[model samples]
Target: MPSESFVASRLTSGNRLFPTVVEVTDSAVIRRRRTLFSRSEESIHLQRIASVRIETGLIWSDLIIESTGGSDPITSHGHHKADAVRIRDLVTAAQTAHLPAATEAGPSRACPFCAETIKLTARVCRFCNREV
Candidate 1:
């Protein structure tokens, strides 16, 4: 049973030990960065996602995926804005699809404020920070 996966480009040469990349799997979201002699990866399980926030800048964007069970969030920085947005959409879709039936209100609807897809019952738009 193959699953869905999203990975960023890792071919940017000439950047020293900071060969960082973003990965999103059916089960988790991952951020990996490597240095001269060390490499680190942060992962956030899809089922544990409590909230996701993205901060967009002119040149780069930051992604933060907070967990529901009190674990540290998986954060990735300096990614292209498009990539950050894509990550958020993927994670949100996965969460909505995997959530327990008891917690699901119904099919999700588009947020009127920002037009970004969000849960049908959501009162706040995560992308535009507006009332839904």
Candidate 2:
């Protein structure tokens, strides 16, 4: 899936020069911060994200994305409340989409046409080269 970006509002403190940008994608969340002399970025994979915390103010919101590895959390503030919420939602949706499928259905099954053992999730038979 395509990535969605949220930028902190410049009106808030510490963002008057270069606002922070947060990007959420199917595989990871990235935060980009810029300064007069340098730029920095932080990223956490979807599977490694532990939680998302949002602190809402009257107008803007703060976002904190914690990692399961006990590393530093990715944080950005001064974003619109709606954008902050959307970022959390997108992270949740992406994590769910990235989860591995259950194997309770069985690992392998016989292909009806080829009578060959194949993965349960396979749509085509490798032995017969036909759709199953």
Q: Which segments of candidate 2 are over 4 A away from where they belong? A: 101-132
Location of the lowest summed lDDT over 10 successive residues in candidate 1 = 1-10
Work out the TM-score per prediction. 0.63, 0.75
Tens digits of lDDT, candidate 2, 68-128:
9999999999999999999999998888787887657569999999799998889988899
lDDT for model 1, please: 0.73
Off by over 4 Å in 1: 1-17, 101-132
lDDT of 1 by residue, 14-118 (tens): 233364677788888877777788888888788888887988766666778899989888776666677778888888888888876675556788888777888
Which pairs of residues collide in model 2? none
Error of 2 at 105 (Å): 14
Q: Model 1, 78: alpha-carbon shift in Å?
A: 0.9
Clashes (candidate 1): 0
- lDDT for residue 132 in candidate 2, whole number 0-100: 90
